[model samples]
Target: MDEVLTCENSRVKFFPIMMYAMVMGMSGLTIMYQKAALWLGFTDMIGHLLMMVSTTLFVVISLIYLSKYIKYTPMVKKEFSHPIRLNFFAAISISMLMLAIIYKEVNVNVASMFWYTGTVLHFYLTMYTISFWINNNQELDHSNPAWFIPVVGNVLVPVGGVGFASQGVLMYFFSCGIFFWVILFAILLNRIIFHHQLAVKFMPTMFILIAPPAVGFLAYYKMYGVIDVFATMLFNLALFFTLLVAFMYKNFIKIKFFISWWAFVFPLAAMSISAMLMYHETKDVILLSLSYVMVGVTTMVISVVMYQTVSHVLKGEICVQE
Candidate 1:
């Protein structure tokens, strides 16, 4: 029993545990830049500086975590099969894409490199994740919003791809992403309705349900340069999910702090960006005001999470795997 406990403890501590949260930090900074430039009509020098810092941290931390993950074969196997841990691949892909988007305005060649690399990596990771779903002997009772991560990465591809890749490539990725989002949305809704309830610690990931359509709206706008009926539908769906999640705020408040709390950050940031895009397109003062409100809210939430995370680290509470 002691041996098994120790193994389980180690698995919790050293898992690719915090990468997804780190990606939230990265995405927040990127969206900050977008909010500043697109809505506020400023250069956002601070946003740029923070984005670079976040990117550096992502590279260094990822290298360290990957090195450690490679040494622990059992931990690696667990990551592949674990529902929550599997979303780390989505975090990685999104982080790479965030880098590409941040750099695209500053350096197109470098942006292209990150974009292509992330696209290839995300494709293989999606395949591997799906293959596991098909072949694993375990029951599929653990489905959650995090399951959308793999396919969500595809929806996000065109965020940077529209500028760096061909139209054909962009359409292929967008179609795959949207298709899977439909299928997974059904599967996850069924699980929520009929299967075991998600643990309190994981309820924060339900915010992930907002990301596909929010990011998809932004990506569609990038590709087509118009908020057509489809784009309107995507944006409205994201808005509906955002409000729906907000109505569940009391449930979120009851849960204690965990790295998974960061799951709330990026999705909010994506919605903020979507709002800013809407404001730009329609010149609607209401959306413009909403964009400002969302930027402030996202910044505050991320700030609070960063503070709590640092406090935990200093107290050595975050070192153990939970």
Candidate 2:
């Protein structure tokens, strides 16, 4: 019984807040199918089912994490303060942001509630994270693509916020998200080139590099409703990063599974959504074909990750101390 509460088998006491990332992934998948149903003339059935699953998981995960917080305040505090783990705190806000997008089609009232709450909470998290960075002397190894988790939520605002909020308000979030993306890119690139290679566990997070520009494209397209030069740049850059990650498949395939693998889901979904947007704008057959490929790949990737996560959970592998 002591071992059940205190040892590596302690699921509740050791529950990681990072579980929120799953909601982000599943939500992205839901939105991707929603886009597919509308734009590609596919049925909305898949999107609807995914929406139910994502929302259910979000509620369940939130309750579990909240229990962990109440029962193990010290552990929760430590996770919140750790330089790397601290970044995932934004995933909570991001999950809310994703949920806002998910519900925008089905229920305006529910969507608005999530949007206002997520928007307010995301801004606070962003400010807190930046402040933490300013005050703390961060180690270089702690610099991974996961750092973008906070900034990505900002770029993502306009995608869901355009109808709910004023243009200027949306612009504020977009501007901060885009500006820091470049700033953080330089820092992340330097660490990857001149410093130590990322530990194997973090290798999956490299896929996160594909997200900002892809989400930027969607957000920008939503704001402007035009596929201008800047929109083109953001979309292509996201595609380039997708190719870059694909080329490094060997690096990813060998690494043992970490919960961090959820890092792959949203970015790929973003790229799929971006491709669908590009096809919507250009009406290009090539891009339409590419969108189908992306949708298929994103579906496969998320499904595989979900299977792995469940397998690990039943085996008592997840929520163990790292």
lDDT of each: 0.77, 0.88
Q: List residue ranges in candidate 1 displaced over 4 A.
A: 1-18, 137-140
What TM-score, over all chains together, does every model reach? 0.91, 0.96
lDDT of 1 at 203: 90
For model 1, residues 1-322, the per-residue Cα lDDT tens digits are: 1221233434444745545566656566576665678577867776677777777767665655565576766776777678657766667877777788877877899888888988988898888888877886645467778877777668888988886778888988889889999998898888788888888877988998889999899888888898999999999999899989988889887788887888888888888889888988899999989888878888887888777766765665664665
Q: Pick by lDDT: which candidate is best?
A: 2
The candidate 2 region of ten consecutive residues with least summed lDDT is 1-10
Native RMSD of candidate 2 (Å):
2.9
Cα error of candidate 2 at position 265, Å: 0.7
Across 9-40, the per-residue lDDT of candidate 2 in tens digits comes to 25687888778888889999999999999898
Per-residue error for 83 in candidate 1, Å, reads 3.8
lDDT of 2 at 212: 95
Regions of candidate 2 where Cα sits further than 4 Å from its true position? 1-9
